[model samples]
Target: MPVITSRDHPLVKQLIKLEGSAQYRKKTGLTLLDGINLIQIYCSILGKPENLIVSESYYEDADNKHFIDIIFGHKPPKITIISNSLFRAISPVKTPIGILALISIPALKEQAYSRKVVFSVLLEAIQDPGNLGSILRSAAAAGVNNIYLSKHCTDAWSPKTLRAGMGAHFFLHIHENSDLKHIAQQFKGTVIATSIQASKNLFEISLVGPTAFIFGNEGAGLSKEMIQAADENIVIPMPGKTESLNAAAAAAICFFEKVRQERDSILSSNIGTK
Candidate 1:
């Protein structure tokens, strides 16, 4: 393994550019994965990364010996050990994890869109990366088959969003910069939108069938075009004086409700069969 000590190293410069600019990542078709957990998930799901960069201190630590051994076990990706200072410069987290991987962005396939999706999420102009990531995490947990983001939404692969998503990205078929209106128009199942003013409560709706839940910006809620495009509009039925739920929180509620409905429906069917 080669050691890098200078901030001006070609790889270091590339990492800096990737970390700061989504455009650079888009141009190069590469993204950065920080921390052991993310790198492990990426390797498990996608295969070997293009490069694995570890800090000299972490590489030398006895506690990390097992992880180092695992990295060496997959010999294709060249590993580079960098000075602690250089590693910190490249890292986006407040507390540096000392390890990062440069990997190609997973390509979205046409087959992904062709599948009969049971549950899906559509986000429009969600500006906060943390909110988007949290929604994705919840979506994955609730067994959402696909996620579509409008063109105005934040970059899903940004470092902040990636950190927020944890390992959920690997489990999802994420389509970013999508046309939400077109998707809504063409969807085979119920297209639901969340609003505070809607007459029907979220729990009152039947989500056992194929469903697509549309969530929008933090302040404005869903666009008029999206609301008009939806098959039905439902509210979360907040009895309290709170004006609104955060986009992420709202999404989680909707997704898990769909999960609960589907699980109960399956149980009912099993009982009838028995």
Candidate 2:
């Protein structure tokens, strides 16, 4: 109910701690949500936040007021309205969204293998949060039902990543600390790994039924251990003098190729039935 204008407020300090320290985020089991859209989505899926950081400037916005009334009228989360200067200090981005919330880390879904067509994304040691987030967004958009993040991958709930993902986390199943080989076997799909040196082009590969597409790190690409574990390794064709595509770009291509193939398969089936 009250505004927190001082930079020294305890809640402000907590946010400062979260912004700088990943360990703190992990320990607290809470991470920062920068944009209003993300916060809104998180709330819809996960319920009320423990606290909300609002900008003094937009605290009275009509739309925001209506949203607050509907979602938080009875028992709102602790709203800590801060001055523009102090809000900037706690926000990760340059332009603060005037709305940020502390959200609990989502629980991972149990791994399953029953779906006839399942696509899971494997980010092998991807260091950049933005890239990983974009890939997750693409994976969800391309109809991948699940995502498997290696232990070495970036934090899926980090602020930067959550923003880039644009709320893709809610729509897809995510598994961390996963074993690709075992996952591949369980899904009974072609365990395809993406690599530049592979002789097989992705287009030529028969990506039908269940398939798991493994996308490696941005710099070193797939670890030799992961590559050795894969049932099939393929490469996307490159026509440019550019050495190769970025990891996110490569992933989009491979994922959509699978989508294309699946669509064609369905169309053929319909034609035969007719």
Candidate 3:
């Protein structure tokens, strides 16, 4: 592994730009994946990273040597060992993980919708990176087929969002910079919009078939255009005095309900066949 002690190294300068500026990330089509788990997941799903960076201390440690060897068991890519200070400078978190990878952003096709996408979540104007990541995680866990983010939503590849996603990015099909109104119009199945004032309860609706769930900003909720474009407007029944749920929490509830309903349907079909 090559050693990099200077913060002014060309690679270090490039990483700093990618970490600090979303525009730079888009321009270069690259992003950073910090932490060992995230890197491992990326390698497993997408293949080798363009560059693997490790702090000097981490590289020298005998305890971590075996783990590193296992990570590179297949064809390894370029590896660099940098000084701790330089690693900290490039790290986004307060406490550096001592390892990270510079990787190309996965390119997704610009299709209206795929036939395999029976269930999806559309986010509109969700400004919080953490919330967006959590929503993505929930969507992936609930077996969602696709995720659509409005142009105003937070960047999906941002470091904070990637950290919060906990590797869900590798498992799901995500489309960012999308126009929710146009997608809603083009959708062939039910488009369900969540609202605080909607009369119908979420459980009362059928989520067993093709459906898209639209969630909006934390404070403002779904926009008028989004709500108006939906085939059905429903609200999660909250008996508690609390007025609402956070966007992520509400999305989790809606997604899992769909999962539960689908699972029950499958079981009922098997029983009928028997």
- Local distance difference test, each candidate: 0.86, 0.81, 0.88
lDDT of 1 by residue, 1-274 (tens): 5679988889999999988888898899888888888888778888888888889998888777577567557364777899988888888776698888888888975554543447889999999989999999999988888899999898888877887898788888899889999999988899999976688989898998889999989998988889999999999988898867889999999998988898799899999999
lDDT of 3 by residue, 1-274 (tens): 6789997899999988988888899899999888888888888899889998889998898866677779878567787899998889888777887888899998875556554438888999899989998999998888887899999898899877887888889878898889999989998789999998899989998888889999999998999999999999999998998877888999999999998988888899999999
- Leading candidate by lDDT: 3
The list of candidate 1 runs beyond 4 A from truth reads 71-76, 112-117
Candidate 2: tens digits of C-alpha lDDT, residues 1-56: 46678878888998888777767887898888887788778878888887788888
Error of 2 at 233 (Å): 1.2
Q: What is the TM-score of candidate 2?
A: 0.90
The TM-score values for the models, in the order shown, are: 0.93, 0.90, 0.93
Backbone clashes in model 1, listed as residue pairs: none
**Cα RMSD (Å) per model?**
2.0, 2.2, 2.1
Candidate 3 stretches with Cα past 4 Å from truth are: 109-117
